[model samples]
Target: MRVWAHDRWPFPLPPRHTYPQSKYGLLRERLIAEGVCGPGDFIEAEPVRWSELIKVHDVALMGRIRRGQLSVREQRGLGLPWSPQLVERARRSASGTVQAAYAAFQVGVAMNLGGGTHHAGRDFARGYCLFNDVALATSRLREARLAQRVLVVDCDVHQGDGTAQLLRPDPHAFTLSVHGARNYPFKRIPSDLDVDLPRATSDTEYCAALESALATALTRDGYDIAFYLAGADPWEGDRLGTLGLTKAGLRRRDALVLDALRGAGLPVCVVLAGGYAPNIADTVDINAATAIEVAVRRTSIDRGGPDAKLALEPRDAA
Candidate 1:
């Protein structure tokens, strides 16, 4: 039930910025307001030590990003203006995922309110991502001897190209990305398992594909932890997402993933990925639904019973 986040996640950006930075705050507030999470459920993201960050990121890239010395081309690829606040936010977000992973080892499940930066590579950032939080966390966890094997379930509309490439040669980490086939970063990197859906794919099709992918991933043994990129961009209303999943469908999607992970007795660290609906409220609603679903299921699993049905209430209250 521990959710890591930081106030600086929503840095002051100029009006009309393409990235929906405000959604992070809105999702956090809505989760509390809707009784899905209590004020105590939140944990501020601590800054990640350089020693840990260097485990996954290139030292030169890290140095430039820290000093705000990224070249114009590098900054352009990052898709975020260089700022001291931005650097700090990226660091915190990376740390937040690591915290969530550690917390999940204690609890059945944990979350990072602003993570899933899968577009960030070891050497560079792209698509508004400065650090591959999940990748860095995976490396840190392995280095700490916390987990022997890891699985990444990326459901974002855009392919987790960076994550796939970063972990391509890593036998200990398994990457499974189910994303829009023709989405951004057209050149897709091969993951351990990739389920590319056609444009305008329906809810049933996406779920079926996901079920197959989950089954395949579960076939492997000895995975100690799972990092789920529960992206909300697959909603039909999303501006960037071409898929056509309804809100209810998206909720079902959340249940499917959470139930599978928790049912298998694996620790899961959930991260909110991309969600850019034309109506920001729609995006917020989808992300909130994910939080509620994970919180509910985590409680049920912790209580030593069947996977909890999606009741959308805090564990103590339930």
Candidate 2:
């Protein structure tokens, strides 16, 4: 499997910032160390072109971001300080998802080690997301004639407000977000299908809701590709997430989503979304498990196995 990563592109953040910037690099390293991915399988992502950004983002917003002209209020809403490096990193991170989407056509699945910036809208940036990468990917794919119908399965703890805002109007795209009803960006934009789970929802409850939602979302056929935002923040230990899912539960969540997408014969592009465990290692473990699940499924599809089963079964706990 080919994986796109942009963790090498450093961005300035204030000391004690809560964005968990280091988790990207940590997740990449853990994937390699655990033999789920090899060093050669990783691709360094380049900054996406302004032309692509304009497809999903407003030209005025792009200009302000490029010129570092964001006002104090805008920066506060972005939840990160603006710098040349930050802008570059955002472009590179978005590029990872775009590249992964293209790569998924060659392989059954591809991944971006750092993406899922789902909170950035056409004219606004918020929730630590400067650009809506998945929306951008959907637009680019349609422009390239690579895909007409697209599916976005966002499993992040927080709603994919930006993605919904941008893509919900398009009949060719379907967006499904299963997030905590009480999480950040409380004023939610409606997705094509939104499954709002209560805070502290357990593994059984979350998984059941996700399965039912996927069934409903998949009812609309003709999707050429799928983008899965497999966020790790739903873990019980996450500082930002109030859900009561264990690492094992998160793994099960991955299996359910991946199985559904792959079963539909849709190429999958995976992105590591939000995860904010108090111990960064815990976050890394969850993301790595996701990478491993993707790799296992890819291998199974390539080998034409009878069943695309997971090589590493879900453990009871982290």
> What RMSD does each model have against the real structure?
5.6, 6.7
- lDDT (Cα, tens digit) per residue for candidate 1, span 1-318: 557777545555668877887887787789889987677666666667777677788999989988889999998887888887887787787777887787677667888888899998888788889889998888777867988789999999999988998986788888999998878878777889988899899999999999999999988876899999999998887888889899898999989998888888889999988999877888999988888888876643332223222112111110
C-alpha displacement of 130 in model 2, angstroms? 0.8
TM-score of each predicted structure versus truth = 0.92, 0.93
lDDT of 2: 0.85
Using lDDT, give the best candidate's number: 2
Model 2 regions lying over 4 Å from their true place: 299-318
- The parts of candidate 1 lying over 4 Å away from their true place are 299-318
Q: What is the lDDT of residue 299 in candidate 2?
A: 40
